[model samples]
Target: MRQTELSITVPATANLGAGLPGATLSRRLGMVTVRDSRPINPNTWTVTVTSTPFITGAGSATQTIPTSRVSYWSGPAVRHTGGGNLAPGQPTSAQAQTLTVPRIAFRKTSGNANNRVSWEPTLVIAIPSGAVTGLYRGTVTHSVS
Candidate 1:
């Protein structure tokens, strides 16, 4: 049997949100789905995530979201029952997974459309009391192998 690589799907960009100084804010990064398309008995894979510090004002002002403040959970799952048959439902409540820079987002044990998995990651950040209120931007990159 031949093993195949894992594939991950995510939005090109997402808004973590905006808020007043000293205010805590949160935003869902939307559904991130992954699949191991390998045609072997046990195709295992892992995913990792990292991000750049949020920056604004000519890239001088900056802030970083602590990895502890980011978390993810399995979202609704779509399953392929059989020949063109599909089913969708919410799975067991998976505990929130804290994110660390270059940390593993998730792992897959096998490959199959029926075994596809997805997650919704949330970023929670607190604006410093002295934060110069303005628009800040950052990037969250995910890698799979």
Candidate 2:
């Protein structure tokens, strides 16, 4: 009887010139109700942000919700995969840092090559007191770089 041994190896390759990081809201905040005398409970919405790097560097991300008039919807807060809950300080503005990675990567690397490159964003909406009874509307914009 004869025995043979074989060796196999895989090379690490990174495709650096394909897709850009992107994000989108799962669904609109659609038809929230606010009363005249009571402060509304914090409403949380989910945002899906893809972690594909921008071909050159780790693609960063940010989110901003403009100040709303009716119902006084304000106090926007953001929580990313990282370990901190942060406030944007004002409406209609993005945070100063790159969005945190939702999980630790396989090789201590960032971007889509690491692992599942999707992030869930938690958004909070605050409706103030004494808001006029009417249909209110606003927009939240997200970006990845």
Candidate 3:
């Protein structure tokens, strides 16, 4: 039997550009690919995502954008293959979820071997009026299981 496996790929970096205080910035995080190669009859997999606070200075409250201020939307899949029901966790902006906790980004159900799903997720950041001015950096993590 083939080796059962599940994996995910995410962009190394996503630059949402500059935004003024109290402004909302949104940008696409590039392509996220999930591959499932399980030979089981009823294979299933899920992709979860999370993020850290974005800090520009010493990570103080004034210089930090909490994970709760970061929102994610796993828009529709750009490409996919094999037979499976692939669904996006947040298909629209109204359904976007905060990054305060691990949220399902994508899921595949009733799929077999050699299946793949790809999508471009968007990130929206809400800059607080009291936020400091500088380049804020944060990490967004994606996992599959």
Candidate 4:
């Protein structure tokens, strides 16, 4: 299973309150979950934010009020690896996989439509040679703003 790439899915829903009457809140939601593959295998992971304030609409303020790009997520991939770590100014031993959301319908502030977002993430975990053996733990955040 080392070379066989695995697949994971991350779902997202946009919610806006009191948004501009003519503006749209629809934005693409993407996510990537990271895991550690370091114990006797690996077990550590990290989430890094590359960009924020993604926009998608007509009013120009599309996704600004309360919008943000997804960092990395968590998945079963962490069970096999310890998810690499960044010490001081060094390269990480492991990497956090990325999840991309190419499509999502934003909930305009005026529209009383359901705008709650929830998603399940899938991650690829790699096992290193000198990993330790132990119980690892982590968490998954559904929203940012």
Candidate 5:
């Protein structure tokens, strides 16, 4: 088995809230390092996450309905590819992605050069009615292929 170890690192992380349906808030995840097999070329991937409470806003604070929703735009992903943005490319194969909340069966799509890159878990933390606010936090469990 050919072993070529590479490192993955994400700079900015994003966690957003859709007040209505158009508004968006981009939060940075972080860097990552995987000690596993690396892919020879870039591949296609899809990222999916479980519905969980992420960031905190207010305690039982009823606010307006958000506009935009949470999204992961690979482009302008905080990396210098020498060419341009390498967005929506491959996060599932990222090296590192900082997480705060606790989730289950959550998956995201990313790229992999050495499987040691950090990733940004763009979680969509929704604020529901009668929800116990005040820094409602948890964790998100990730899985890659």
Candidate 6:
């Protein structure tokens, strides 16, 4: 018997461009690919995503954008292969969830024998009224299990 595992592939970087205070910046974080090769009964896998606060300058309140202001929507699978039931966490912008905590970005249920799921998740950041203008950096992490 061979032991396989779940894996994920994410983009190196994503830029949401510039936004003015009290404005919203939205962009797709490129394609995220989740692969499951584990041969197990009732094979199921989930991909969870989380992000850190975007900060610049001296990291003061005005220079920070909390993770709670960052919204994520899995939208739909760009493409998939060898699947079971693959679903998006947030199917629409109306249902987009904030990144305050780790959230299920995508999942697969009841599939076996090597499956792949790919999606382009969108991120929407609501710039606070007091936000300062500068380049902000944050980390968005994706994990599969």
TM-score-wise, the better of 1 and 3 is 3
TM of each candidate vs. truth:
0.68, 0.25, 0.95, 0.23, 0.36, 0.95
Task: Give Cα distance to truth, residue 77, candidate 5, Å.
Answer: 4.0
RMSD of each: 5.4, 21.2, 1.3, 20.3, 9.1, 1.4
| Candidate 5 Cα errors over 4 Å, as ranges | 1-26, 32-48, 51-76, 80-121
- Cα lDDT computed for each candidate against the true fold: 0.58, 0.23, 0.91, 0.26, 0.34, 0.91
Candidate 4 lDDT (Cα, whole model)? 0.26
lDDT of 2 by residue, 1-145 (tens): 5332211111122221211123222222222111111122221222212132211122112222223211111124321232222233223324212223321111111221111112223333323332332333333333211
What are the per-model numbers of colliding residue pairs?
0, 0, 0, 39, 60, 0
Candidate 2: misplaced stretches above 4 Å?
1-116
Which prediction has more favorable TM-score, 1 or 4?
1
Query: Model 3 has how many clashing residue pairs?
Result: 0
Q: Which of 4 and 5 is ahead in lDDT?
A: 5
The local lDDT score (0 to 100) that residue 108 gets in candidate 4 is 14
What does the lDDT come to for candidate 1? 0.58
TM-score of model 4 (CA atoms): 0.23
User: Residue 128 CA error for candidate 6 (Å)?
Assistant: 0.6
lDDT of 6 by residue, 62-96 (tens): 99999999999999898888858888999888989
The order by descending lDDT is 3, 6, 1, 5, 4, 2
Worst 10 residues of 1 by lDDT: 81-90
Q: Tell me how far the alpha carbon of residue 60 in candidate 2 is from the true structure, in angstroms, after superposition.
A: 35
Candidate 5, residues 33-88: lDDT per residue as tens digits? 22334454553222333323344565223432221222232222332322212333
Cα RMSD, model 1: 5.4
